[model samples]
Target: MLCDNERGVSLGTVGLKVLTSKDAKKVYAGIVAAGLRAKETVLETAEKVQASASDVLAEAQEINEARNEEIFEENK
Candidate 1:
């Protein structure tokens, strides 16, 4: 099931069932489309998280450098 996959469970024993009947093709298509959309959302969110983390790291480095410069100036 999707829950097992989402939770990082091993799916060796899992069985996937997507109706492939002539009348069910549209249903299968909709399911695939929805899954693709969800994947896109997760990717976008991960990118945002990475960008925010990098920004915070850069700010901290800048602050530390400024403090070091101030100390160096005082010692001169």
Candidate 2:
């Protein structure tokens, strides 16, 4: 028997048991929905990671600029 959970319906019994048309449709829909949710999460996480990387790069550039200015002043 297939189990239902908070995440989604289980598909573990797909090949183990024979399913009716209605049950098959439900399984297909669940799979599609899960796939879409996964894609959205990936995109969201990627955006966050990209933004963080940009911030780190900007900070590094600022630090390098400050060090260069200090060296220039010391030489003068």
Candidate 3:
């Protein structure tokens, strides 16, 4: 249902829409787009974290190799 003429508005889940305006539907779509963008940002942050973890693991492996070589020389 639409709002009363006195209010000039409609109920929206995340954003307001003018009751009689052309973009009332657009208003709802914009709210949905905002939600999608927020979700996309979370996914992007997760990808960066995975990349950082892989880099750290690679560095640790190189250090282990050097340490193993040093231990072998000492034993010899």
Candidate 4:
């Protein structure tokens, strides 16, 4: 959409049309709503990934602690 050559019309021409069109306001509103929805989806996915990473780290720490205790007992 940012690139202007495919439609045989320049970006300036399209911008002008969108600005003056009767339903321009509605079109812009829809664009804004779609963008907000996308942003929300991205944030939710990022939170899930962070939670999974934290869980894996906790499991790793437990394994390491168990290994250390085994080594200490073997030495004694």
Candidate 5:
């Protein structure tokens, strides 16, 4: 038998349980905590990627400048 309660659904005698208010609060807290942790992880990865990209751009600029100097010298 399946029914809807004010809080959640009830499935009778199949070992399924409904969330009481307290249990619901705990579940909500857990979900929030997980979301925070995931956000932190994503932010950390983004920072690392940004730093790496900056380094690559700097290196590429240096190489281009060196090549420009070589061409200028050859034309002299």
Candidate 6:
């Protein structure tokens, strides 16, 4: 019996079990699917963070080089 529960494993009666071996397999599958989706989200977030850091580093390097060039010109 299907119930309006998130896990789909709701007991119909006081002595009834909703989960059998097959039901366990489906639950496992759902867990695996959720894990994969979470992993994908983590990977995507990491990529965005890495890219932002790279851009910031590049900008800092450019600013440092400009400062160095100005210092050399002053020394000359």
Best prediction by lDDT: 4
- In the range 1-76, model 6's lDDT, one tens digit per residue, is 4447733433344224444467777998999999999999999999999999999999999999999999999999
All-Cα superposition RMSD per candidate: 12.2, 9.5, 6.9, 7.2, 5.3, 7.4
User: Pick by TM-score: which candidate is best?
Assistant: 5
lDDT of 3 at 51: 100
Over 17-59, each residue of candidate 5 has an lDDT whose tens digit, in order, gives 4455667779989999999999999999999999999999999
Off by over 4 Å in 6: 1-20
User: Clashing residue pairs in candidate 6, if any?
Assistant: none
Ordered by TM-score, highest first, the candidates read 5, 6, 4, 2, 1, 3
Residue-wise C-alpha lDDT for candidate 2, range 1-76, written one tens digit per residue: 4346622434435543556567887998999999999999999999999999999999999999999999999999
> Which pairs in model 4 have colliding backbones?
none
- List pairs with backbone clashes in candidate 2: none
Stretches of candidate 3 off by over 4 Å are 1-24
Candidate 4 per-residue lDDT, tens place, 5-63, comes to 65656766888888978799888889999999999999999999999999999999999
Compute each candidate's TM-score over C-alphas: 0.66, 0.71, 0.62, 0.71, 0.74, 0.72
Clashes of 4: 0
| Residue 32 displacement (Å), model 1 | 0.8
Put down candidate 1 lDDT per residue, 43-63, tens digits, no spaces: 999999999999999999999
Deviation in angstroms for 22 in model 2? Answer: 2.6
Off by over 4 Å in 5: 1-20
User: What value does the lDDT take at residue 21 in candidate 6?
Assistant: 60
Weakest lDDT window of 10 consecutive positions for candidate 4: 1-10
lDDT winner between candidates 4 and 5: 4
